[model samples]
Target: MAGDGTVEWGEDRPVRLMDRLFGDAGGGGQRLSAPAAGAAVVALALFIAAELVPWMSVTQQQQGIGPDLPSQTSDVSLDTVGWGITAAYYLGLMMLLAVVGLVQVTRPHTRRALTAAGFGLSAAMLVLLVGAIRRAGEGGQYGPFDQGIEATVGPAPYLAIAGVLLVVAALVISGWRPVMATGHRRPAPADPDEDDDDEEPGPIDLTVTPA
Candidate 1:
């Protein structure tokens, strides 16, 4: 505690913490190009939209027990029920990457790391989706009926694919052609040479005596 009752911290404690939390800190913050930023936002929106679409469909067929009733067929789209749980898992990962992009969009290193992570997540999700499809084709059962329940993927996963593609595109664009969104307003580093810039010279004496 100091005279003002404030605990004294080391000179670089807070700064070092901020750097660790938000990546390298120094001259100024980074920014993404307008198109890149817009695409990122769109990706976020698409990902959210995907949650509402159907992810799986099933068809059922039945035969008449007697002779009066004809065979019946019905189609069922399991929207947010069959594969919604798995898609929710993927959405959680996507949302994490999206938050990282929005918060540290200008930090190239951070963005690169996040992009790589996103790619890994997408790959993992792809593998799981393929496995699920294979299982469904192999006569996976949804209920008591086994012979007529044919499962197929719906629109939700496709929407997720679009969202992931958009996110990747934005990251690639910003990474390939880096641009500063702000002007030259970075703080000056501490140096003896720049001390004079901060020091204000006393006003010049303008009054002059009669010659």
Candidate 2:
């Protein structure tokens, strides 16, 4: 009960919720670079472009009797399925991080960041693996080692290694920056006085005493 026009309140519900969520945020906080995001977007665009446009060609050889042989050139077909999957993966990753950044959401915990990266890479790799299986099933000219290398080189093994490398590269690129340490231990700001003390040198005694 208050006689005055202004009434005293105990606490605001929304304020409490916000404080819990953002931990009494004091400043604008760490942010993702818009330029970096743009770069990612451009790279994704290039990948899509390469997939859509006829950018590469392959050569085929034919054998004929009497040494009459000609080299045949053909435009490389799009790995439509594989390229689409890769495009989606890149776009999805950019969108995921962009939304988080735009919303001012803090970077996820390190473990979660790594896990997301791993999972995304695995999903992409799974798509490629499926495609390779289909190619094998279709009985293409691909030899026993049809994944990438010839029969002399193991295709399946190379593809697996490639997938692993992709995951590692993505993980490194996305999560290399330092963050709040594992224990949330923030670095203490340097004390101004301590800095001055370091900058100034102590006096040297003129008389030297031998020990």
Winning model by TM-score: 1
Clash pairs for candidate 1: 30-106, 31-106
- The TM-scores, one per candidate, come to 0.53, 0.33
lDDT of 1 at 173: 69
The top-ranked prediction according to lDDT is 1
Report the C-alpha lDDT of model 1 over 82-101, residue by residue, as the tens digit.
36546655675556466437
- Writing each residue's lDDT as its tens digit, candidate 2 over 48-142 gives 45345432233445655656577665443324223653455456545544432333233657545645655565565556545544543332243
**In terms of TM-score, how similar is model 2 to the real structure?**
0.33
lDDT per model, in order? 0.55, 0.42
Q: Output the worst ten-in-a-row residue range by lDDT, candidate 2.
A: 148-157
**Least lDDT summed over 10 consecutive residues: which range in candidate 1?**
73-82
Model 1, global lDDT: 0.55
